[model samples]
Target: MGKITEFSEFAEAVKIANELVAQSAVAISARKMGHRALTVHAKPSASFAPGPSQEKIAAALAPNASLLKEDPLPGPATPIHDAVLARPSRLATPAPKGSQAAKDGIYRGDKLANALYAMCQRGGFSGALIVDDNGLPLAVHQSPVPEEAIGAFAIVLGTALAKAGKLLGQHNAENISIDINYTEKIVLRRFMLGQSPGYLLVICPQEVDERGEVELSIEQIAQILKRA
Candidate 1:
């Protein structure tokens, strides 16, 4: 579903957030009211907590938020848990020099090798490479499938990431999530370049099992790229 632009008040946003944070037993009033923005926060911790930045945005809307007045977003010193979940994160390690690494070449065998290991545990599909946005290999763990097929899979995944960036309006696509199908697996992919450009994050699961696990793994790998 596309964005819902309803609900014109900060009170509405807060009301929805409170209900979600509580794990309310009923469909939220905001959902009933069809408040799109408010409904987004209907899940626990999904609401963007109000800190200075959020407070600033809220103040521009309603005078203030009750939750914000009492509590706030994680302070600067607060240790962030999942880096991916953070709205504004400056903690990622940089990938490399401005131009030391080729922007369009080199396979990321380091990361792919690990992903391959996990997929192999379940007799998963042939492994495909993860490549940067520019079609450079960031990593490659060979799938049990024919070696000749790997390049095409990588390229196809790479193309998907490039198109997705434009669709999402993000500088880089975020992560490779998993959505399983029994006989054949459905792989959700993402690409991000820390130093140069992002590469594909390929996922082949026995079946669609874990979304959170996939997200966490992608973030960990992305962090590695940031420092490389």
Candidate 2:
């Protein structure tokens, strides 16, 4: 009976750890994709006082910060997603050409097409794309985004996001969801797959209050990727 309690505790710990890995993956992906919404609310640099240097204060407090310490003891083995998230800096690094990990981490070809198609068919979303870490599309479903231009768009947007985060010192961003009020409302959501640096971009019309459905569908797609 005592052992059963221990087993339950262990199971609970594992579950929490998995959740952390998943969140970390999303954060890494968000950073890589250059999600701008995450930093939209950050206090402007111009607002800082012209007093003592912020750098000095940070340096003085550095030693006491937990993040400044050596890496913690190894946790559960990191899968591709966790590994990519573990090194937040990797998002800024150039992807190696011909590297198998980058190629294989998220299976290519229409692997994600069906899921994306289903999501788009649910209504509101105009299109969807499952993109790899490098912004190359693995699957594109009904997106007006031209197949030839997807990669370039991803790279440009990601670079912008990373630059903004760095300037604001908000290096960890989980995902980017933005609603643009144009002639027609447009919603854009960008999030990472749980097992890789891969990303999912969903673009939808803001009409008809379909935000909840869109969110649920994206989450369902993430779960499916985790099991894949």
Candidate 3:
């Protein structure tokens, strides 16, 4: 190749400079148009924060000054016996004086409690609880386990079992029996007391039935409460 002439070199350089200027003008025009489009087409938006809306919802749901005092919901530490003795508010209240339920010998108070204790002793039960359909204890007999705890467990577990039965098309589940064979066997029997929707809950060691004495004690308790 020969050495390029100065005129030819100057001509090539001028051509490149013109091309670059034209391209830069096009780029500047595109950027200006883009900026104009963004400014003109963009819409103002109203943003919402979750905090305010959530606060409003919570305030609306909270109890107001006019709201009345409500009864306690069914849950742990709700004091079952106290609620049972609170008032004659439950529909299954004791039979009126001289009425059929009264004549049938509806047991209550210390007499009923003593009877339950004796029944537990006779059956060698760890604990026993007689509760209404609402899971309120009418009578409880203590042993190694607290009667209140046994009653609560019975209501919750038995209710779950009954619901499970109903879901499987077995409505009005009459009994829920659980036997746990661990270091020591634990047996729990919950059955509907005859006639009423009340329940008779018996918790006893597996050994209690080794001699086959539990069945008789249960039968006696059932017979006694059937009149109630």
Candidate 4:
């Protein structure tokens, strides 16, 4: 009797799936190419801040203020997503000159990553992109962003988001941005001077709302990266 019931359920699901696919095909053909058709709110939030409905849980991406460090035991994942400084077991190398690519008085790629880890810790952000002054990618991790997506974003995307904040104008340019999906995220941020004059690319899990975080974080990080 249980087997018979399971088969019945499977058949019903397949029937619905076929019908939906047929409907979707018709909708696609009628829709404009690259046209986003999602319904918009009557009045999108006037405030520059992301809508209140989309804020991440405060503690989710809270900053790591703990002074105590964790023991670096080898983990299954590679250096890609793991914190480079904190993990002792991995063969992490020192960041070289121009590797960080931040502007004067700003922070480095690692520092930016730490800041983001503090802000959007809810979970979806999985990686980041640390770039240099020239908008070159230095380090990247866990992000689904293709290498091809990097070029246009370097100056154009950075400048556009800067209108949302002051960070973009601080150093004349920023090299990083973030892309957030439902359960995954990537931070494309710039990191500035010290030993490295480039950015730090970070990839992280998507724990917060991607739209809000992506807009705010990119502008801030870009400016900070040039200064770093």
Candidate 5:
């Protein structure tokens, strides 16, 4: 009886081990099948034959050969409708050659401001202002710095340069430049506005030379002041 019981226990243990081994084998086979399914599904099926030959492709495109020659493939997409093609472009036109005031032969404070604004836009200056000798801003356009502070500083610098030039027995300074940094500088151009000394102060990049713009601005300012 004891031998029979031991034989039975050993047989049961072997059966369990064999069952575990079979389950492990089945799991590995299932994992391999899953990976193969994913790989097979991820790629185009091999059952599909290759594309048409060049001769067949040419035959297919022969009907539209003239169109293909005139306008190649991958050109701009066609507009949805004739109206879409006919619609006027919304792109902004270039700034006018000169200010409206100058063209109309009308000069006023607002017109002067507009002219300055146009000048700054054309010249690409950071800011510009027309100031009196007392350092008061007459017209300002897109002033990057405080108008009053810059106006006052422009007057002070211009006065200092003028005094220095006079002391050396030279002509009064007409243009005074103050370097703010290596990249930017302030330019002061002295002009006479009906017997009153007015200054055109422009802040621009150091490399930009806007002498023509400055001169034009001076002329415009003189005309505006005279008319005012």
Candidate 6:
């Protein structure tokens, strides 16, 4: 009787445990189904509306169309006036023919000095001097040293060179170069004004074209002398 009682209690306990397990499984299944239903209903659905058409956009901006339009291109530039385009002269008017100024010795001397200055400027000379055959300075321009001394020496050198040329059976030396130092030189140019011989002594670098400058100086001097 005791063994049978023990067996019956064990069977009763197992049946209660089985029923509790089944109830727990059914509760878990119901919770999972509730979670899935809540998830499906909680999410928001995405929806899109159509954008405005081109015609609507144009109508909206019609009020500002004038501001948005580009400015018209500038018209062709006006032609410059002849008087406006003309450059002003800087030179003084010359004295009229046979005028008192033209006849004045002082005026002629000034003109001769101007001619010498122009020659020096054009040939890049350190100085220029015009001397008569008697070794007298007629005009001087931008002289670095004493013009009178240079004039005297130039005449002596020109005479010596002319003598040397005649000895060699050559014409009178028209152009004579004397090297003063390594970088500087003196060019003595012989030219004729009327029947008298004239001298031009120029101090410049050794590399300058002495002959060319001399010829140009001769032409300028001739013009001034003729005018006088």
Cα TM-score per model: 0.37, 0.42, 0.41, 0.29, 0.51, 0.52
Residue-level lDDT of model 2, residues 23-141, one tens digit each, is 77534443444322211111111111112233433432355533224322123332122221233210122235777525654332333555665665555355556655555555665
lDDT of 1 by residue, 105-181 (tens): 32234344455334333333333345454334444443222222333344445556567778877646644433322
Give the clash count for each candidate.
16, 3, 0, 55, 0, 0
Question: What is the Cα-based TM-score of model 3?
Answer: 0.41
Candidate 6 lDDT over 70-171, as tens digits, reads 311112232111211232311333556788865672355456667766666566565667767766666665444334445556677778767877797667
- lDDT values, one for every candidate: 0.41, 0.46, 0.46, 0.40, 0.59, 0.57
**Candidate 2 local accuracy as lDDT?**
0.46
lDDT of 3 by residue, 1-228 (tens): 455545787779878878998777434443333221111111111111111233332333245411111312224333233322332321224557987647765434334455655655555454456665555566655422333344445566667667767797776455565553321233444555655455666654443442234345456556656654
Model 2 deviation from native, Cα RMSD in Å? 24.0
Q: Give the alpha carbon lDDT tens digit for every residue of 1-228 in model 5.
A: 577647878889888878987777433443333221110111111111122244433433454544334432122332212222232322222234597645764335455666776676667666677777666667765454334455556676768767877797656668888666555667889887667688888866676677989998888778878876
Local error of candidate 2 at residue 53 (angstroms): 48
Q: How do the residues 1-228 of candidate 4 rate in per-residue lDDT, one tens digit apiece?
A: 576647978889888878997777434556455433332111111111111111121211124312112212123334334333332321223444564433332235444544555333432444444444444443333223332233223433444445545744555453343433343333444434556444444444434445555556556666655564
Clashing pairs in 6: none
Off by over 4 Å in 6: 1-99, 102-106
The weakest ten consecutive residues by lDDT in model 4 span 43-52
Pull out the clashing pairs in model 3. none
